[model samples]
Target: MAEKQIVEQVLAAPSRYVQGKGAIESLGARLSEIGSTPLLVADDVVWGIVEEPLRRGFEEAGLPVTRVGFDSYATAAAVDELVEAIGSGGHDVIAGVGGGSVIDAAKAAGHLAGIRWASVPTAASSDAPTSALSVIYTAEGAFEEYRFFPKNPDLVLMDTQLVAGAPERFLIGGIGDALATWVEARATARAFAGTMVGDRPTRTGTALAKLSWEILWEHALDALEAVRSNTVTPALEAVTEANTLLSGLGFESGGLAAAHAIHNGLTAAPQTHGLTHGEKVNIGTLTQLVLEGAPARDIEDFIVFTTRVGLPNTLTEIGLSPQDTAELRAVAEAATAPGETIHNMPFPVTADAVLDALTTIEAISRRVRAAHGLAEPTPILTP
Candidate 1:
């Protein structure tokens, strides 16, 4: 194999993305382009919310769609089981209709089955709906490994009404995930790091990452407020797109850095299993900024905004304490483990440095909380 003179630029995303109220009602029509007999991947919880529209759509299209129950994390074993089950069912396509873990599991299973897959997110809880990679986890929910597919989902349909109907925590968590896009992308760009696509970031991917952040920075609070009132506004719509699509493409194509690496580190702690992916990633983003020696004002600004949106930034908030040296050290070690995206930082990263950065952010978070009289985030996660 000859070494290339330049790193190939990459920008990965779903082949098609559709978002609006009642978008899932059109799922049967859109998915027909990919396959006739499709498998719907969702758990009982998700099935309860989307069953009507999904069944109606398929029935109207005069097509057969089978349900694939998924309630666990996207573990390797789970993916293997799903692949075998799907192969036996003769499903030509798979469509995940739930949150991050379900979508990831569907993507992994569909890829292994050599069948196309679609994403039908009922909640904007994380940016997993449009990517080509499955973040496989352990049965206990610890970070396991990443499974990549040949392409992104064939269709990504985000029903804003359904997203709005979900518990507000989902949207908040999604915002947290979207917030990391720009921060991680900036670092990846700074270091010219490799992406999930096995290539360097493109200008287009970086631009989308920046846009995702800007959208959240502008509309997150408003979107949260609207969700609290059980209403879907323009702010909510914009935020949903930012969290689902922009962040998905940005992280996959633009590359990841310490933020996501730190999130994986958090998974090493069992106490944090209840927290959503975006919540952990939000904490990771703050830690990454600290590790980078970013401007104090920038860090404080992030704290201020995220605090208002209820992102947990302190050790205690995430079920860790400053006194828990062993656990914290474990997290630091995981963040700096071999092949972790923390290496994407322009500077060499060590577990000790990551540990120090975590401590620094705790103090910074405390200071910001005191100055603003802000309360710690409530409802750490949703069911």
Candidate 2:
């Protein structure tokens, strides 16, 4: 057999990232840098919050703008609708303003339309803002596929005040999502797997992933406190940027392994429907640690971090019980499915191995929680 050739490495990122309080108030200037006419895509709720500033800024800058509401999931149909809505209007840019799904939809639409785009995240809930890919879901919210773009967003605009004013759960969710970057990147590096950017991990991606983990460990608690008070503090800013920018670039170019694969697999369980992406990834991180046979101290430290940030640290906390064997098996099978990034682990992974890891990690998490006097988590169930 012939040896396969691979690219050495790749690093990808948005061209511009601006973060600060009242950053959206400068939207017009930023838009002008890209295009004079931009299609603004946001949901009704987010539009209500940002409309005044967005319209005023554009007017002041003498830029023409078109507004459309993205009320559906990031489904193929939704992207098609967005494309049609863009129509023959001669829009030069697409700006997504809201949460992950809205940003994803906008990215997909922009890619299909062959236009540049920007991501304006109103909440620090996920690492989708700075990436060049979108997770498309079925209209009913089931995972469908990942859609990759030729380039990352042209701009990622973060309004710290808007983020801080969001409900604290969003920030906590972002922390949960950011938690897996280093662990997964390390595993991918060991396996020499190709990253989402279509090459080997670059030094920049590796450093960013490690630094993101360090920031979470050092600043997550303080950042959570700041969000609770609706105040923008240094800790809050650092964690928010770590969650969005660092984690975004890290995962895309550093690659993913079992943690994100497990998160995708977990979507098979209906009991997990109410949980956020980061929350599930947090549990997946614990499972990944156990799967890799990490040291007890390391697992314990991670559990403590998750607990402090109010992330689910156990199966029960994530709405699964020891007796849910069928669901567990489904998750394991899904995690180990063909094309899943679980194969990016240095070791060959099996569904049975994932099942065992899930069980063992839950037991370990319970022990850690008890030792730390943490209350048992009340499971979140979908109606």
280-357: candidate 1 lDDT, tens digit per residue: 998899999998899988998999998888888887778876787899899999999999999999999999998988
Judged by whole-model lDDT over C-alpha atoms, candidate 1 comes out at 0.89
List candidate 2 stretches off by more than 4 Å.
1-6
Worst 10 residues of 1 by lDDT: 374-383
Candidate 1 segments exceeding 4 Å error: 1-6, 376-383
TM-score of 1: 0.97
Instruction: Return the lDDT, model 1, position 269.
Output: 91
**Cα lDDT of all candidates, in order?**
0.89, 0.89
Give the CA lDDT, 0 to 100, for residue 375 in model 2.
Answer: 73
lDDT of 2 by residue, 1-383 (tens): 99997568999999999999999989888989998779999988998998888788898888986888988878899898888876677788999999998899999999998889999999889888999899988776667788888899999999999999998999999999998999999999988898887789987897899999999899999999999999999999999899999999999999999998999888888778678889999989999999999998999988887987899978887888777899999999989999888999999999999999897777788788889998766675544
**Any residue pairs clashing in model 2, and if so which?**
none
Per-residue error for 351 in candidate 2, Å, reads: 0.8
